[model samples]
Target: MISWLMLAQAIALGAIGAVVAIAGIMRRPFGDWVLGAAALTFLTLVVQVVASIIAPIAGAGPTGDLLEYWTYLITAVVIPPAAVLWALIDKKGEWSTLVVGIGILACAVMVYRMHQIWFVQVA
Candidate 1:
């Protein structure tokens, strides 16, 4: 994954999360925002996956073993959909909010992992 793109995605996800939190605080229904965020994240992951696949074929520097990268990629792709689905099932007050919060937390963690991967490569 491109470091700049990863960072951009993280920032976007963070913004989405913040919007979710604000909506929750204001007692607004944020299901649409949640879904939108998930869709956007999914799109970003698609780009990351394609880039990762092509990088090796283009004879780029070591990224890591394909299996290891795939593991991270799959997890990144799965989390948002899972969170959105769970949120949809939970109509109870604050549950959806919790889902968004958790999703945001996961995104933050992924961003850190992406950074770590880049750091390892640079070292």
Candidate 2:
């Protein structure tokens, strides 16, 4: 994984998580802003998927266990959409928002972990 891309993902997801959290704290329901943000974050993960495929070909392959890295990456890619669908289906207002917030924050952490596995930990 590219270092800058990893950092960008972390920061963007963290910011989105914070925003969603604040909306939940304010007792807001699942709204367009939240949905839009989640979609945007998911789009970034799609980019990450493409980058992961290309990076190895470009000589930036992960130094850690490929399985672990791919697992984290796959999970990160799945979280946003799943959380959004859960929120929409549950329609529990602030609770739904909070759940999505938690999922986004979790994705941010996973992105950081993926960075570690890619660049910090060596197999």
The model with the greatest lDDT is: 2
> Which residue pairs come into collision in candidate 2?
none
Residues forming the 10-long window of minimal summed lDDT in candidate 2 = 90-99
lDDT of 1 by residue, 24-119 (tens): 666666466667777777787778778777876777644445555567777877887887777787756666865765676576567657556644
The TM-score obtained by model 1 is 0.78
- Model 1 worst lDDT run, 10 consecutive residues: 60-69
TM-score of 2: 0.95
Best by TM-score: 2
- Stretches off by above 4 angstroms in model 1 are 25-27, 61-66, 118-123
Assess each prediction's global lDDT (C-alpha) against the native: 0.69, 0.89
For residues 30-109, write the lDDT of model 2, one tens digit per residue: 88888888888899889889999999999989889989999999999999999999999988655888878888889899
